[model samples]
Every structure is written in structure tokens, then in C-alpha cells.
Target: MTRMRAKPGRRTPVGRDSRDSLRRFVEMLAEKHPPLSLDAADLTIKDPEQVRRRFGRVFGYLTRVELEVERNVLELRVLMPESTETDRIFYEQVWWPQELQHGVLLDAAQQGFGMMPVPIDVARVSARIRVTGALSHLPGMLGVIRLLYYLTGAATERSAVIAYSRLLDGLRAMGEHAIAETVIAPIRRQEPGHFAYYRGSAEALVKEEGLSDWQLQLARILRRRSFAPVGVTSRRQRADFGDVARALHLDRDLPAVARQISLVEHELLWAQQLGLKVPRYIMAALDEAIALSTARSAAQSVRN
Candidate 1:
């Protein structure tokens, strides 16, 4: 057992309504959610052909992203220098270690089908982000940055929960029970706690006076301008994300998927519009990724 390194969260991380619950949640996370075991999972591929193409692509991209948690942590430190201790504890202590292990399991599963490990770039954050992180240290700016962090966390984990759910079901449908149960189930179970923490923390900040109206507006703008599907860094990567969505069948019901991801932002940033379904920017990003994927396929077909 790798010793869980988080301090039992002793401070109010979010505000009053959710602070107690979120703190308890954090404690639960530290105590209960160690990384899923690597050796215990039977990475047996009942039928490698069943999952080797589309499903393997999904695993490849998923593995690449989870392994990049190290980079995410480094970027977080640079981006939110004024982050709370609890934030530090969650990301560094709990989230990073667990996610890196997820990458391991996913990589192993994909390799069972003879898939190559996806190339990853955990090198460093872009120069732009470093500058922005430095600027985030300005007074009253860190609150906005923190709230955005929570919001980003919420959306990313929600997407993960949905993707893992779909993947789990798909595996069972194909009778890939061993990895489905041991690998995917264990991984999927650990995700909701992360989602809860992010959702609760973001909800706490948005509902309380943690962010001013200007800060909220700023967050809205930043998210609109900069939202990319989690772990996507390039056009090729965006297309790969689209491949994951399609393989998982999330592309078929994009509004529903988009709703899951963008719901919090809509509630927080567009509180007046009760009838709004999905944010335009999120939908646009998804659409573009899928379209890019389609174009990539067409180009490949022409070449072939």
C-alpha cells in the first residue's frame, strides 16, 4: 500500500454551506481512495479484435492524459501560485498519484491488445500559461483563478465519469469482463469522488461570496476563450478526443454529453437563462473536434 500522503483536511476549503462537507469529502478521498492496484487487475483480452481499433484509441488517449497528471500538477503550481493548502493537498497528494496509476492500468490494458503506448508530452507548460499564472498573483485575481480551477476540475471529472461509464457498459456488452470489472470498474468508482470535490468546491465558491461579479465575468470570458476538451493540446489531439467520444458513443448524443460538462458553468455564469441546454462554446469545441476527426479520416482515405 503506497501511503496516502494528504493531511486530514483541517481548514475550511470552500465556504460555509459546503466547506464542512467538502472537507469531509477530502478526508474520505485521502483515506479511502488510494491508487487502484496495478498487479491485481487481469489485463486479459478475451477478444483483442473487439477493442483494438476504436476502443484501443480511446484507451490510448485516456492513458496519455492520465499520465500527464504530473504536468497538470506542475502547471497548477505555476498557474495558481496562491492556491489554498487543501488545493495543494488534493492535487499533489491524492489526485496526481492516483491518476498516474490509472494511466498505468490503461496503458497495460491497451498493450494487451498489442497497441502501442500513446506518445505523451509532460514536458512543461507553454510560455503563455506561465505568464498568465504570474499575473494571477495580483490581488483579488487568485479568487477568480481558483474558482476557474474548481470549475475546470468539475467539468473534466464529469466528462471522465461519463466516459468511464460508457466504456464500462461497452466492455460488458462485448463480454470483456475481466478488465471491465477489475480495471475499468475500480477506476470508474474512484472518479465520482473527484467529481464531487470539484462540483462541491465550485458550487461553494459560486453560491457564496467567494467570487465577485467581475471575477465571475472574467472567468466566463476565460473559459469561453480557452476551453479545450481535457488533455487535448493540439489539433491532432482534438481529433483523438473526438475519436474517444465517438468510440464511447458520446458523439451521438452530444447535447447530453455537453450538458453534463457545461451544466455548472451555465448555472454559475448564465444563471438568468433557465431554458439554456448547453453552452455554445463547449458544443463548438466538441463539434470542431469531431469535424477535424472526420476530415482526418477523409484525408487518410484519399491517400490510401
Candidate 2:
């Protein structure tokens, strides 16, 4: 575990309001939700070729949704202690199964389009994260790291909500109403609550603890470097993400999407965001991924 020497700041009390909010989220979890029957019959693509092309692109990256839960659970168990048990419970009991089911449904949909699903290797928490987790056990460090976790979660889930919204629109426009209704809508619906949880948690923590400039900078740097769309973990995932963005015509709106995702961080990190639409680092990373994907596809075509 990488032991970080964070200033020993006073512990911010996790107040009753935060606990109440978590309880509300807990009460909302349903064991079974929409898209309950995602077999081959559920796919309503009028053109299977487009389905194979477009829906396959979306489904190809759903594995990250599942693997990330594993990483979150492992990291949270280490970083979140007794006071933050509600956050941990929500992830384990509510979020994990919901996200895993998303992967399953997307896989089924992709298979219906005659696309082979990529196998997901569930990620174990790595030594570096474990070390960071251990460092988070310290008093001053724990609060800051926990705040980062919530902030990261907020940004990520907000991005997911936006992507799924765009995807739902694209599917509906293509006259795939069944998918728009059953698969995309339901999954997107659940994401807002998760985002709300993280947003509320972050707001509360930040209000209570108050961020130093150094803390804000750390948050900015971490988010700038680490933020990736769902299912983006490797070079291949980046390519897949880029392919999906292009297929869905999302390439043009990425700046807007990036801006929306960075709202909280912008407020935290910059004074009036300094006229930045989105962080340059994040935009650069996305551009690089798209270029890589294009190059890869071109190379494969030449080989064929």
C-alpha cells in the first residue's frame, strides 16, 4: 500500500442528513427491475445489420460496467470505514447487482445480433490501490480520499447517464422502441439515483470539511487523468469506446458531454471554470483514443 502523508485534518462528522439520504436510496432498490426478460426475442432492431454494427458497438463495452463494481467494492471496503458504511452498503447491495445485470442484458442483446460477446475478466483490486487504501486508513487522508471517491463516482455516473440518454435517442430514432424502452431507459433511470448519491455525498463532505487549494488540485489532477467512459480500461476498450462514439454520432457532442461531466470538478477546481468548456487533458485523451481506434480499423481492413 502506498502510504501518503496527508495533513492530519480533523474528522468531519457524517451527519444525520447523509445517513437519511443513504437510507432513502436503500429503500429504492428493487430486486427485480425493468428489462427483466432480455432474451433474443427482446431485440427489436428492424435492420439486423445495423444492429450488428451499432448495437454491437454498445454491447461490446458493457463489460466495464461489471468489472468496475468489483474494483469499487474492494476499494471502498478499504477506504470507507464505519461512518461511511451506508455508502458501502449501497454499492454492494444496490449498485453491484444492478450494473452486473446491465452487462448481462447487453451481452444477450449483442448475441441476438450475432456478435460474439467479449469475456470480462473481473478485475481484482491491485496492489497500488490496496496501498492507497491502506494510506486512506489514516485520519486526515481518509476524508480527502473518500471525497475523491464520491467525486469520481458522481462524474462517472453523470457521464453514463448522458451516454445512455444519447444511446436511447439513437435507438428510438432507428425505430428500436423495444430496446429504447426496456434496455436503455431502465438502465439509464437507475443511474441518476447513483449519481445523486455520489453528488449529495460529495457536497456534504466538501461543505463540511472545506477543500484546501492543494486538495482541489489533487482532485482535478486525479479526475483529469483517470476519467474514462464506462468499459474503458485498456487500449482495446478505448478503441471500442471511440468506435461506439463514432457509430452513435457522438463525436461531435463529446465536448458538451465532457463539460457536463466536469461540472462539479470545475466548480471545485477552477474559479468560474476559467472559460474552459472541458478540461484539456480529458479532451486530448478522448481524441487520442478515437485516433487509435480509426488507425486500428484501417490497419485491419488493409490486412483483410
Could you say which candidate leads in lDDT? 1
The per-candidate count of clashes, in order, stands at 0, 2
Error of 2 at 40 (Å): 12
Clashing pairs in 1: none
Instruction: Give lDDT tens digits, candidate 2, residues 138-246.
Output: 6566666777787777778876887788888988888888767877787787887777777667666665445565565666676676776655667887888788767
Q: Give the TM-score of candidate 1.
A: 0.92
User: Which regions of candidate 1 fall more than 4 Å away from where they truly are?
Assistant: 1-17
Clashing pairs in 2: 1-131, 2-131
Q: Write the per-residue lDDT of candidate 1 for residues 210-237, one digit (tens) a residue.
A: 5666777788899888899987888889
Cα lDDT, all candidates: 0.83, 0.68
Using all chains and alpha carbons, the TM-scores for the candidates as numbered come to: 0.92, 0.83
